[model samples]
Target: MTVRYAANKDVQIAYEVLGDPATGVPLLLIMGLDYQMVWWPDEFCEQLVAAGFAVVRFDNRDTGLSTHFAKGDSYTGNDMVDDALAVLDAVGWSDANVFGGSLGAAIGQALALLHPERVRSLVSVMGTPVTAGTLRTLRYVRFGTVAKLARLPKAATREQEIDNLVTVYRTVASPGYPFPEDWARHVATLSHDRHPRDPGTTVRQNAASRRFTVPALSTLTRPTVVIAGADDPLVRPVAGRDTARQIPGATFVSYPGMGHNLPEELWPDIIERTRAVAR
Candidate 1:
């Protein structure tokens, strides 16, 4: 992946462009909270490329190789949304199809609402809208799953941290599919090597997410598709249904046996749906 940078004010957002821009439609990929772009598998990207898309994946601020923040410094959700716009400008694409996973899905919602002219379409998966706020957002979460995953012991070394993350991935992974342990480990290792695990970023990202509200989803005009893993242990399927219901003409899809983790088996279906949405 060739790394590039987009300046969102003083922040230099790190991004990478895959596939030939001249040959395929542009697809901006946003990963979940505190998760780097590396969490997006190269194989999945390659498949998207083969399907005729020039994929642009970026590390959100406070994650991966992107700029870090001080203990007290904070940014709003618009900052994160504009960070994406900066990336689009860097890639020279006026607009593109977008795919956001988990917290990314919420960001995508905000992106479409905040900059309607810059997004051709959006695909949101395993996430609740940040605009939903604290209490409303809590309704969609399964606390038992969160409690189990949160119980992992803290790690002092890189290897230990990788192990802890892999365990988290496995626990939330789809129950009916074979676990992609290798991909999970690779993502964890990259996440650790690029930046040591910091609990502060997670807290900050969560805070910014909670603070964002406006342009209620009903006012959104972009073509969108909300995907939910029917069996997700973290965010419930109803969240996806509700998100789609709020947007006029938006499509809602739910897959049984899918969880917080994106199963490779569903990639084809998602890619095709993206093609339809982007059109």
Candidate 2:
């Protein structure tokens, strides 16, 4: 994978492209929370590529190799939305199909709402709509609890960091799907050794999400799909359903016994749904 940087004002966003850019439909994948673009899974990207899409996955600002903010620096959710647009511009695509998970989904919603001309289609996976009412519902209660509990203590060593991530995944993983503890630990170790954890950046990103509020999604006109895990402890199915309901003609799909994490088994279904919506 050739990692490239896209300039969004002073901040530089890091991204990688999969598949033949010239031969397939352009699809942008937006990752959630403070998770790096690597969390999107190379296998998943390959499957999407095989399904005929030029997949572009990026690290949002304050995460991965992207521009990291100082402790007190502040940026709103709109900035993140604009950063997504900058990635598209850097990649020479005027518009592309967008698929986002969790916070990435929120960013996609804002992008489709504010810059409708730039989104050909959208797929929001495991995300809640950006509204006060939705945020206050029971759907978010479990997620909020898990999120709070997932907060890790300062790790003085790489091993501790990996352990923390493993614990978090184990805590939030779907009860039915086997939790890949060994693989999760390996990835966590690699990520921690590579970039280390930046709690400050995560706080800033969370602030942005908390402050953002989209009053109504009725104005969004692009073709949209919301994919949810039926057993998702974080960002429950209702959140996905509500997001789909708010947008005109948006479709919602649910996977049985799935959680916030996207398992490899669901890649085919996700790719098919994306193709169907984009069509």
Candidate 3:
């Protein structure tokens, strides 16, 4: 429950560590676009800790308690990758196992490619490879969903903000998994109260993802696992498969009826798969 800051060049990245570092492999969890580290469920982190991992969850630059940027001064995706390395250095770990989703997943892939020595293992969940070409042609099968996300209404009031977030979760959530409306509302409320909503930061992050192209990944030697939701409307399952196909000896897993959101029911499987790869 203790929060700390790690210095990365000019920025101070905020992070929280769970479980004893002396106990197990260091596991770093990276969250997605515009989402803070708090988006990672406390229970999910606890389960990984109980499974013998020292978990480190952090706010990626413009999100959470980390450093905020001016309108046009945001860092690019490669800069964020170095930020991850700085987090490891701050914690006195030479290397660690990494798990990321969405944007986080893209960062994890870049980390494995650029700094292979710093990553012990990698797990990418509901993420796609971020190449310049992919960004140029980024279109989901559900074009209507993309349109709705693109035109999400701005909320001037707290209640309206929560409602907006609820709508978002509903729009992207897996049809087969129960949507936890109440929990989503709670998280939205906390996020709204904790930090100022910055649309520009999200825009810059998206641009960064598009600007930074991943190097050829067919030669990646790190143990990697790619997880995709069969019904994911955001990134799509094909992107996940494509990522795994690029990495040699990497494992790919798809959950039926799952979407962009990770449900509590699939956590056990995620933990087991992550542990297997870490071994």
Q: Which stretches of candidate 1 lie above 4 Å from their native place?
A: none
- lDDT by candidate, in order shown: 0.89, 0.84, 0.85
| Model 3: per-residue Cα lDDT over 1-279, one tens digit each | 888899988899999999987677899998888888877888999999999999999999898799988886856889899889989988888999999998899899889888999999999988887552543337534577878977888888878877876787788887778888878888877777768568888888987776565578886789999999999877678888888998999999999989988888899999999999999
Encode model 1's per-residue lDDT on 12-61: one tens digit a residue: 89999999876789899998888889888898899999899999999999
The model with the greater TM-score, 1 or 2, is 1
Return the lDDT, model 1, position 51.
91
Q: Work out the TM-score per prediction.
A: 0.97, 0.93, 0.95
Worst lDDT 10-window in candidate 2: 132-141
User: What is candidate 3's CA lDDT for residue 35?
Assistant: 87
Give the best candidate by lDDT.
1
Q: How far is 115's C-alpha from truth in model 1 (Å)?
A: 0.6
lDDT of model 2 at position 201: 75
Worst lDDT run of 10 residues, candidate 1, spans: 206-215
Question: lDDT tens string, model 2, 140-170?
Answer: 6475746565566767777888888777766
